[model samples]
Target: MEEIKMNTIYDNEKFFNKYSQMTRSQKGLAGAGEWHTLQKLLPDFTDKTVLDLGCGYGWHCLYAAEHGAKAVTGVDLSEKMLAVAKEKTAGYPVNYLQADIATLTFPVATFDVVLSSLAIHYVADFKRLILNIKQYLKTDGILVFSVEHPAFTAEGSQDFYYDEKGNILHYPLDNYFNEGIREANFLGEKVTKYHRTLTTYLNTLLKNDFTLLNVVEPTPATELLALPEMKEELRRPMMLIIKAKNNL
Candidate 1:
């Protein structure tokens, strides 16, 4: 197996420092508004074994445990994040493993569900990760994950720019075809991320024999829409959520 390089951005104190302060609900899976959307796509966790890839802070692991999961295993590369996860998930039927999710190994058919939230984008070999996930999940097991939207990542830049009047401006769409590593500022820290087109994400699952279940680009709730700052998300999707099943 080829060794996969781990992205150390999350391990940086600057990023996790800000992340550590946020509550689980405030983080909301990928973002603040997508939690309910993700929840709707989830299968019943009652007594199921679940694995959360790149499980930062153990939020989803704890969530699975809370929802009657028999065992929840969380894998993350960041020791700092794992420490926080351990502290937060103490006493839960959850295990936190500090390992590069891309290179982590598990027994075949070990999990009923594999979950990831905005984590795989940091992985360079997403195809390998998907294939490994297929091996880890039981037949009919589900994989649910969210990532930075291809449209958003395509631009390389963040979002729309406005004039002094705050009127809508053009949203940049550049290099949509170029899919690879991208560097950007996150919470004032320069970070590395891997960008893959929507087709790449879909075709990867299909090529691995995963049956598509659902795809969602969530919209903010009414309360969020009430904020002027949140209106831009309505203009363009920031995240992509996908649910697929292991049919083989």
Candidate 2:
């Protein structure tokens, strides 16, 4: 219920080091497990202005620029992440800003498309954030974002219950209706995340004059199932992607 300060945990040396090594961090959008589905939900970027929230490493920013976006802005709170984003973004010419997405503002109708990848759950005030986003977006502009699924966040621990043999027994789901701060351990460090139900996520958008276009819960593709880790994804949905249009 209460908003917390913007989380800059990604700037921590150990966490940043670990995050920098992730497949998505190094190889960009192609390396993300949900990219296949998320990409499908994205509106064509051709000559449109784009704003990417929590744009760690600027993967989506570069993708938009390369795909014909006229202007692209990437915002994040972590300096370490922005450093890497700036370095890797050589010729793409993305405007990367080290600012908290929750507090950052843009002029009305500033962007044609707003994108956030795997970062919304960390926000403490979901409703307020989206309202701000709606104001920044042009009429009928698109908003596409991915977050840790509510089912995955419902358990608080954000991990699976395992059997004695170390096989995942189930991804436990409890306190699903209790939406608030969730202190999760990631990369050997504690990080803050917020939990919100699917109902809240959808209804909030609908109430804010945004029309839902698509809601995708991505899973590994058939070919990816051959990998040992990909099979575990079938047991529970880990990510949620939503695409909506701002209707003035």
List the global CA lDDT of all models. 0.83, 0.86
**lDDT at 13, model 2:** 73
What lDDT tens digits, residue by residue, belong to model 1 across residues 8-88?
666766666676665433554544666767888988999999999988878889889999999999999888888878887
User: What tens digits encode model 2's per-residue C-alpha lDDT throughout 25-111?
Assistant: 776777677888888888999989999999988889988998999899999989988888887777775888888788789899999
| Per-candidate clashes, comma-separated | 0, 0
Pairs that collide in candidate 1 are none
TM-score, cand. 1 vs. native: 0.90
Measured with C-alpha atoms, the lDDT of residue 151 in candidate 1 is 85
* Alpha-carbon shift of residue 192 in model 2 (angstroms): 0.9
Lowest summed lDDT window (length 10), candidate 2: 1-10
Where in model 2 is the C-alpha error above 4 Å? 1-6
What is the lDDT, from 0 to 100, of the residue 210 in candidate 1? 91
